[model samples]
Target: MLHVRAVCPAEHTAEVVELLREHPGAAHLVLHRGAAVSPEGDLVEADVAREAADEIVDGLCGLGLDRTGGITLEALDTAVSDAADAAEEAAPGEAADAVVWQELLGRTGEESRVNATFLGFLAIACLLAAVGVLTDSPVTVVGAMVVGPEFGPLAAIAVGLVLHRGDLVRRAGLALLVGFPVAMAVTLAGVLAGSAAGIFDPGTIDGNHDVDFVYQVGPASFVVALLAGAAGMLAMTSAKSAALVGVFISVTTVPAAGYVVVAAVAGRWDRAGFSLLQLVVNLAGIVLAAAIVLIVRWRRQRSAPLLRPLSRG
Candidate 1:
C-alpha cells in the first residue's frame, strides 16, 4: 500500500477529495482545507492500494495537480486497517504486477541525473573491473558489475523511450554519454598510477585471460544482455527489485568499458576495439529489450478497463 499526501489548489480540493472517496482502491481520506500556506491550498491525504497507484497518480497529473500543487507517495510497510485490506482487494490488478508509472518516472528521474555520486560509483566500479581483468579474477569482475551504477540510467532511457518523454531521454542520455567517458578517464588514470608504482604490468591485459568474456563480444553476450534487460524492466515496474542483482551480474557493460581502457593503455588496439564493441553491443541489447517490454506493458495497462478508477461526480 501507499500513503498519498497532496496539497491541492483551493478550487480543486473538493474534486480531489471526491476522487479519493470514490476510488475503490483508496481509503482513510483526510482533507484539511486551507491547511497549506506555501502552496496556498488544502492538504489531502489517503491510503491507496499499490495496484491503483499508477492510475491514481496519472489522474492527479492529468488534473494538473503535479504542476499547480504537490503530490507525494510513501510506501507503507504495514497498514493494519481493514479498509486498507479492502482497498487492495478491490483494486483490479495484483500489486506485484502493477507498473506505477509515476514511481518509475520519479525513481529513474533521480537515478538518471548526472551527478558526482553517479560518476564516482561508475568510475570506482570500472577501476575495480580493470583490476579484476588484470588479475584474471572472475569474482572481482562480478563485484565490479554489481558496483556499477549504470543500470539506473539504462532503465531510465528505456522507460523514457517507451513513454516518449524527451526530458527523461535527454537526462538519461546525458548521464550515459558523459558517465562512460568520465569513468574511462578515471580508469586510465588508475592504470597509469598503478603502472608508475610498479603494481602490475600493462601486459597483464594482453593474453587470453579467464576474463575473456569482458571483451569477447559474441551472440551469447547479446542474448544475455537481452534477457537481463527484460528482467531488469520487469523488476523495476513490478517493484520486485530484489532481482536487480542478477540483472547487474548478468551483463558485462562495466567490465567491457574497463577492459577497453586497459587494452588501449597497453597499446592493444585490437583488444580495445573488441571491448568497445562489446560495451556497445551489451548496452544496445539491454536498452532495446527493456524498451520493447515497457511498450508492451504500457499498452496492456492502457487497454485494460480496470485502469479507470471509480470517481464520484
Candidate 2:
C-alpha cells in the first residue's frame, strides 16, 4: 500500500473527496480543509493500494494539482488496517505486479543525476574491482559488483525509453557516457599509484584465470546480462532493494570496467580491448533487455495511463 498526500485547492477539495469516495482502492480518505501552509490549500490524504496508485495519481494530476499544489507517495511498511486489505483486494491487479509509472519516472529522474556521489560510488566500485581483478579474487569481484551504482542509470535509461521522455534519456545517457570513462580513469590512476608503491602487480592481471571472465565476452555474458536487465527493471519498478542487489551482482559491467583499468596499466592492450568489449556488450545487453521488459509491461497493461505523467499541458 502507498500513503498519498495531496494538497488540493479549496475549490477542488470537494471534487477530490468525491473522486476518492467513488474509488474502491482509495481507503480511509482524510481531508483537512484550509490546513496547508506552504501551498495554502486543503490537505487530502489517503491509503491507496499499489495496484490503484497509477489511476489515483493520474486523476490527481489531471485535476492540475501537481502544477498548483503537489502530491507525494510513501510506502506503508506495515499496514494493519482491514481497510488496506480490502483496498488491495478491490484493485484491478496484484500489488506486486503493479507498475506505478509516476513513481518510477520520479525515481529514475533522481538516479539519472550525474552528481558527485554518483561518480564517487562508481569510481570506488571500479577501484575495488581492480583489486579483485589483479589479485584474482572472485569474492572481491562480487563485492565490487554489489558496490557498483551503474545499474541505477541503466535502469533510468530503460525507463526513459519506455516513457519516451527525452530529458530522462539524455540525463541517464550522460550519466553513463561520462560515468564509466571517469570511473575507468580513476581506477587506472589508482592501479598505477599502487604499482609505484609496490602494492599491486598489474602484470599479474593477464594470467589471473580466476577473474578472466571479466574480460572474456562470450554467449554467457550477454545471456546473463539480458536476464539481469529484466530482473533489474522489475526490481526498479517494484522498488525491491534486495532483488536489485542480486541484479547488480549478476552483471559483469563493473567488473569489466575494473578489468579494463588493470589490463591497460599492464600494457596488455589485447586484454584491455576485450575487457572494453565486454563492458560495451554488458551495458548494451542490459539496456536492450530492460527496455524490452518495460515496454512489454506497459503494453500488457492496457488500462494503465499512457503518458499521463507527461500531460503537463
Candidate 3:
C-alpha cells in the first residue's frame, strides 16, 4: 500500500476528490479544503494499492497536479486498516508483484546522481576488491560486490530505456562512464602506493589465485550477469529489498574493475585486458537483461484495463 498526499488547485479539488473516491483501489480518502498555504490549494490524502499506483499517479499528473500543485506518494510499511486490505484486494494484482512506475522513477532518480557518496562507495568497493585480489580472498571479493553501488545506476539506465526517459538514461550513463574510470583510477593509485610502501608486491602476483575469476572472462560470466540482472530488476520493481543483496553478490562488476587496476599495476597487460573485457561483458549483460525485464513488465502493465485516460470533468 501507499500513502498519497496531494495539493490541488481550488478548481480541480472536487474533481480530484471524485477521482480518488470512485477508485476501487483507494481507501480512507481525506480532503482538507484550502489547507495548502505554500502551493495555495486544497490538500487531499488517500491510501492506494500498489497495483494501482501508476494509474493513480498518472491521472494526477495528467491533471497537471504534479506541476501546478504537488503530489507525494509514500510506501506504507504497515497498514492496519480493513479498508486498506479491501483496497489491495480490489486491485488487479498482488501487492508483492506490483511494479510501481513512480517508485522506480523516484528511486532511480536519486540513485543515478553522480554525487560524492556514490563515487565514494564505488571507490571503496574497488579498493576492497583490489585487496581481495591481491590476497586471493573470495570472501573479501564478495564483500566488495555487496559494497558496490553500480547496480543502482545500471538499473536506472534500464528503467530509463524502457520508460523512454532520455534524461534518466543520460544521467545514469554519465554516472557509469565517469564512475568506473574514476573508481579504477583510485584503485590504481592505491595499488601502486601499497606496492611502493612494501605492503604488497605486485610482482609477486602470478595470476593463478582463486580470485582469478575476477579477470577470467567466459560464457559463464555473461550468463551469471544476465541472471543477476533479471533478479535485480525484479527485486527493485517488486519492492523485494531482501532479494537485492543476493543480486548484488551474484555479479562481478566491481571485482573485475579492481582486478583490472591491479593487473595493470603489475604490468600484466594480458590480465588487465581480460579483466576489462569481463567488466564490459558483465555490464552489457546486466543492462540488456534488466532492460528486457522492464520492457516486458511495462508492456503488461500498459495493457491492464485499470489504467485509462484521465478526464478533467
Candidate 4:
C-alpha cells in the first residue's frame, strides 16, 4: 500500500538484498546499483513497499551496513513494478530482521513524554472548550476535541506497557498529572474573566440551559474514549497519521476539563466535582483500552515464526 526508497553504498548491496529477501511482509524490491555520486561515489538505490520499510531500515542498521555506507528510506506515492517482487522472491535470504529491543523500548519512552508542543496545544484546546462550556455549544465542544493533543501521551503509555519501558510509563503519567491541572487552571481563569466582564453569569449554573450536555457523562462516554484510544494507538504506530485527528475529536477530555473550569467560576463545587469525575472516567477508559490493544499486538509479534537465512541453491 505504501512505497519506500532507500540508498546505500554499492558495496553493501548484497547485505541489503539479503535483508529484504528475509522480510516476509516486504514485496516488490528494486535495486539500482552504481548510480550514486556522493563524496564516496556510486551507491545502491532500493525501492520497496512502505509496510516493510521500517523493518528493512532496522535490519540494515543492525548488520552494520550503515556504519561504512549510508541508508535512507522514504515512502513512495505510486505503485512499483511487479518485476521487483519477482526479483525479491528469487533472492537468497531469510524472512526476518534482527529485533533491536532496546532501541524500540527507548523510542516508545520518548513518544510518551509531554513535550512543549503538546502542552501548548492542550492549553489552547482547554481554552476553546471553556468557551464551548460557557456558550453550551456542542459544535464548539467538538472543535475543542479536534484541537486537543492529549492522545499522543496516552498512546505512548500504552506502547510503554507492552514493551515494559519504565521511562515511558513515568513520562506518560507525568504528562497526565501535569496536563489536566494546568488546563483546568487556565479554564478557571477564563471563566472568572468572563464572569467579571458580565459576559457570563455564575447564576447560569442552575438554569437547565440546553447546554446541560456537560453534566451527562456516562458509559457511552467511556466507550467513546476506549474506541478513540485504540484508533489513536494504531495511528501512532502505522503510517496513516491523518486518522489521529478523528480520534482526538471523538473523546470528551477537553470538554469535561473546560466544564470543570466553568463550574469553579460559578461557585458550583458539586458540578465541578461531577465534571472532574467525567474527565477521570474518560482518561481511564482510554488508557486501559490502548494498553490492551498494545498487549495483544506485542503477543502476536512474539508468537510469529522467526525467519532463517535462505540456503544457497
Query: Model 3 reaches what TM-score against the true structure?
Result: 0.95
Residue 152 displacement in candidate 4 (angstroms): 0.7
Query: Once model 2 is optimally superposed onto the true structure by TM-score, how far is the C-alpha of residue 129 displaced, in angstroms?
Result: 0.6
Model 4, span 112-187: residue lDDT tens: 5677777778888888887877776778888898888777677767766666655677888899788878877877
TM-score of each: 0.95, 0.96, 0.95, 0.74
Per-residue lDDT of 162 in model 4? 67
Q: Is candidate 1 or candidate 4 better by TM-score?
A: 1
List the lowest-lDDT window of 10 residues for candidate 2. 304-313
Clashing pairs in 3: none
Best by TM-score: 2
lDDT of 3 at 309: 22
Model 4: residue 145 alpha-carbon error in angstroms: 0.5
**Residue 20 CA error for candidate 1 (Å)?**
0.4
What local distance difference test score does each model get? 0.89, 0.88, 0.89, 0.66
* Per-residue lDDT value at 74 in model 4: 45
Distance from true position, residue 269, model 2, in Å? 0.4
The superposed Cα distance between candidate 1 and the true structure at residue 276, in angstroms, equals: 0.4
**Model 1 CA deviation exceeding 4 Å by range:** 304-313
Candidate 4, superposed: residue stretches over 4 Å from native? 1-14, 21-45, 54-58, 64-73, 83-111, 304-313
